[model samples]
Every structure is written in C-alpha cells, then in structure tokens.
Target: MDQLPTVQPHSPIMAVLTEIEYESGMEPSFGSIHDFCLELQELFTSSGWFFYVFSLKGVTKDGITGLYRDGSRWTKSKMPFPDIVYNRIHSRRSESSQIFIDFVEKMNEASIPVFNRRFLNKWEVHQWLNSRKNLQRFLPESCVYSRNSLQRMAASHEVLFLKPVNGSRGRDIMRIQSQDSTCDVSLSSRNGIESLNTCQKEDLPAILKRYLKKQLYLLQQGLPLLKMDNRSVDFRILCNRSSKYDWRVTSTVARLSAQGHFAANLAAGGDTIHPLRVLRHFFGEAQSTSKLDMIRELALEAANCTADSSEELFGELGIDVGVDDNGHPWIIEVNSKPSKNDHIGKSSCRPSAKAILEYAQILLSETNPPEKGGSR
Candidate 1:
C-alpha cells in the first residue's frame, strides 16, 4: 500500500480525511453519505489543500487515501502535516479502540484543527444543547440513560426512541411506542419496517436488558411529525459557520420517509422535496409561508446555539427539524457531521453543497481562538 505523506507541525493548511473502522460485525455498508464524503474531499482539494482519507481497508482513489490495519508495519512520507482534519470515524468502531484515538490525540496536541474535534464527545454535545435556552425551543426532551432513567423516560413519554449515543445516518435506532398496556418496538432501516409487534408492559424488563447490553444509548421523546401520504416527513436543515463566526443556513429540504417507516432519513428510501411545498401541503398557503420563515429562523438559531456552546469547530450541522400538525417546529436531532447529499447531480439543492465547500475553505484559511482559550 502507498504510504501517506508525512506532515510537519507547521505545514501549510491541508485537510486530512480519516475513517474509524467498525468492529468486525458492526459497520453499515457504504451509502450516499460515502459519496458525499468524496465530494467534500474534492472540494477541499480544489481549495488548494492536500486532502487525504485514511481507512482501515487501505487507500483508494476515491479520496486522498491512507489505511491502517492491526500489526501491519507502515511509514508516513516526510511532508507538511495537515492543517485541518475531518474526523469521520464511525462510533461503534471508536469505542475501546486505541489506534484511531491515539492518532486524533496526536493531531490535537500538534494544534491541527479537527472539524469535529475529538474531545467534543457526543454526550457533551447533547449536554450543551440541553443547557442552552435558545436551543431548548427547537429540541425535544432528551436524556442520556442509566437503567433507571431509561425506564422512567419510557414510562413518561409512552413513546421514545432509543438511539446509539454516537451513531449517525440513521442506523441502530429503535423506536418504542406504547399502545395502552402494550409497547411496540421497531428498528429503523432503509427498506421498510424491520420489526413491529406488541410487547406487554412486563416485556420492558427483557427489552431494556437487550438494549442495555449495548452499554450506550440515548432516550428521546418522539416528535409528533407531520405526515405525507401516511408517512412521517421531517426537515433536514443544513447550516454552516463562516470563518467570521457567523452562522448561515446552507439548505433546508423535506424528507418524506418510506411508506410504513417511522423515520424520515433520506438514506432509508426517503425522498426529498422542497420544504416550502411540504409546508404548504401540511399548512395552507397563508400559514405555510409564515411557517417556512419561522422554521428557517429556528434552524439558524439552533445551529448557532450548538456552535457557540460546543468546544468543537463545527463548520456545518445537519439539524433534523420536525413540524407538528399545528405548524410548530421541533428539533429532532443535531448532526455535527452533516452529509453533503445536496450535492447529488442535477438537483436544485446542489448549490448548497458548493456553498458549504466554499465556507469550509474560508474556515480553513482563517484562525479562530480555541474555545477554551477565549471568547470568539
């Protein structure tokens, strides 16, 4: 395998793309997001940065490539170190993994700006969001779980989603809904409902046991989402912070979940539509117009809140916002590494991806004080 170019501590700005490999049994097959990652690499490359991607499976031409495997001897080229690193490590793979963690720590101590800084753990992000007042308006009730907390949350919400605390792109999510004395559990997927049935209240013990065996998950109250043709629809609001620290909305689109599915994730056979049209369909013309404006403002505010409170230097966020029947907007999830799906060919939203790339370039060029050092 070809070796990665060695980077100096004070080298010119370059973007490092690295992947965190999953455990042998626990990786999602590559999908649209993988393509988006490539587009980001191209964008970074075009902006005069040496863009490189490292994965456990060895390098490929798809992105500036590097690879790592256990017990494999390797060497890095003598070149200037990357100025910025895009940490795209998968979460399940990261748990109890030393190699990638060590690499990230070394980069941090060297003052290389990581897009989603390694120190900014997922729980910290959630905690930051929970503490903010402006963000509270958009967020659903969310809590990190202990066995007692999870049980209480389940009993209180009657309908909750159990999500891997660090998971992304809609994988390993289980929705638990209560119908009178029975509870229904369903796993999220791209094809269709993976499982659906009624479980007696007494089944909670076993279900919780199975869920807790994983050792990490978050319980969130399910948002009452507006539906299209009997399927839930939610909005993905893309926002990016400019080098100047101003937060801007890059794109907002509605994702209608596949029929019979509860999630509105695009990866799961969900189709995209203009948010305005969906707003109109759910709310009449007069109300829809006003609601769109409201949603846009809320999204920008949510993004800013996350950016300001968190220690990470986030250039972008993919915030999942759901609209209820009454046209109220609620933040369902906040994604630090928002997918660049808007860049897919010949789409009206493609420009958003270009804009994000440009913003990333600006961020790479400018220097901001580290969050711990001082105020921005």
Candidate 2:
C-alpha cells in the first residue's frame, strides 16, 4: 500500500460562518460558541492552525470583518478569508439571506469547499433518503404536511409528529395523538411539552392551517422508543466526513427526556449519558454491544446517504437515532449544525472538537495538496 500524503504543520486558516450577536456594551458574543471555538483553538495550538468566527455580512472584496484571537482575548478586526469555511449560522432564516447565498456562490466560483452551507429541510431530506430503497427502512413514514397529508398520516399511526421543515433544538414540533373522535395535540419546545388542548378530529385542518400558516411542516410516523424512568430514550451520533462518501462516527451518547416530555434533545431539557448505561438496562452485555454497533452502522450509512444525496459538501453531521423495544433502529433526524453538549462535563476536549479539526485538515490537504516527499 502507498503511504498517505503529508500536510504541513502550519495548517491553513479556517473560518466558521456564524451569526454575529452583541452583548452588554456592544461586546460581541455568541452563546455557547466559546465551548467549541475555544476547544478548536486549544486543540491544535502547537499544530499552527488558526480559526475565526464571522457572520453573513462579514465577507467582502478585501477581507472579513470578524472576531480574532489576540493572545487570550478576542478582538474584532478585519482578516483575510480562510481556505475553508464551516457553516454554524444557527438560524435557517439568516442562511437563506441573499448575502449568505451570494457568499456560497462566490466560494463555489473560487473552488472553495464550504461544507454544510445550508441547513437541511426536513421534508426535502426525508424525500432524499426515502427515495432510496436501502435507506427507506431506517426512515419513518412521513409526508409534507397538509390537511390531506396529516389526515392520511394520522389514519395510519396513532401518534404523529408535526415538524416544521426548518425546526431546530426540538422547538415548534407538534405531537398529535388520536383519541377516538378528538385529537390530542401538544407542542414540544425547549422548556418542555405544553398542552394544546384536545380538538375535534375534523377541526384539526383549520387549527393547523391557522397555526402553521405558510411555513412547511412534515407529518411523520411516531416511533415506539425504548423508555427508561418513564422518559423516552434516543441516541445522538456525531459523524464527520473523512472522504468522499466516507463518514466516521465521532461520538455516541444517549439522550433521555424528562418524565412527561416528548423530545429527547438536549435543548429540550434532555439528559445526555453513556449509551451503554441505558442499553445494558434493556439487554445483556453482548446484546447491548450488538445494539450499539447496529445504531452506529445505521448512522454512518445515513450520513453517507444524506451527504451523497446533497449537491454541496458536508464535513460533519449529528445523526439522531432511536431504537424500538424490539431492538430495531430508526432514523430520527440529521442535523448539519449539531449543537455542542457543554453539559457533558469538561473533563477534556471531547473527540468531537478534535474530529472537526481533523476534518478541516483533510479539507486543507485536499484543496491545497502538499508537495510529495516534503514537509512545510
């Protein structure tokens, strides 16, 4: 076998595309960004990699107006665009702006690889993955929300989820359960589940029509997830793109919702813990291992399919999966801009930060390959 190409220790500067927000006295700060950004800086300190955060309007003909590291302090200044950009702009609305769109077009014109350029539309993603035969098994039955679609989906599944195509952090999702003649609708948000009161089955059309308005929604089949402590349990698998059609599972952890809660996302007050702790509770040691292995395999395959289905590039993803009581795995969702878990205890930099740094290096090496048999 041939040896791998060597990249220089002085890696190219990387830019994280984000939304700029100001704090007290106009001190710019993005909530919870420091956890991941600082980790990026600290991880490859000796390896000569520089990372900076900027927003949609920061790009220009000369350079970017972004926050930079000046020793231990962050200072706002003009800096040159880096070799690669990773999108972290939280809002899909901001990402849809003309400024962001133009930047991506220009980057493509320059042959710059900007992975995760836009957030995935849940309906579009479901169609992409569902259209593929091999991937369909892992996907729950879903359809673009409509009076007809919702009614159709409701007819099959006793419980259904009404998810906004652009929803995030487990916010603005509607859980509707059939109750003989009435529909019990509840909404899921970061705080917890809020009752929306029961409504007549026929009235759901008008109710959802006014509430959802023009925004797109996906009505999906709800899963019968494994529950522990009266709360539903699911797994989050962080995967990073290693090569074309190649993805590596970076971290796997189980998220358990509090009692009476429907969402298992950390943003929704869910708790993150080792997958084994919960898996072992349901199955024997060997069976638990098998279950986890199956989940990871499904996650990687889902990542590959999702990436392959997209026209743009993707360097990382957070694939959420939930296993049923029968030990079957189902794809919950795929997130391009996955949230970082600051609650996981700052014992050390989670491999997630390192995985991102390594993927950035891979991008650097690919776009600007090093000279053979030499070091910089």
Estimate the TM-score for candidate 2: 0.89
Model 1 residue runs over 4 Å out of place are 1-13, 19-80, 90-96, 118-123, 154-156, 189-191, 342-376
1-376, model 1: which lDDT tens digit per residue? 3454533223334444545333455532234455554455456545544444455343222323342111222223222345566555545465236755665566577566667543234566667776877667667777776667766877788788877776666777788888788888888766676775567876765765664436577778887779989989888888777555787776788888889777787667778888888988878888887887787787777777778886667777777889987777987777865655543236533555466566655654565433322111
Q: Write the per-residue lDDT of candidate 2 for residues 1-376, one digit (tens) a residue.
A: 1122223345566778876777767656766666677777676554576567788777876656777665776677775556778888888788878878888887777656787888888988888778779878889898888778887888888899999898888788889888788998888855677887688999988777656646888889998999998899999999987665589998888999866678787776778899988899998787999899999998998888888888878888889999898888999999998878723555567887787778877877777633321121
What local lDDT score does residue 3 receive in model 2, on the 0 to 100 scale?
26
TM-scores for all predictions? 0.75, 0.89
Clashing pairs in 1: 6-77, 6-79, 7-80, 7-81, 8-80, 8-81, 53-64, 138-331
Model 1 has a clash total of 8
Tell me the deviation in Å of residue 266 in model 2: 1.2
Clashing pairs in 2: none
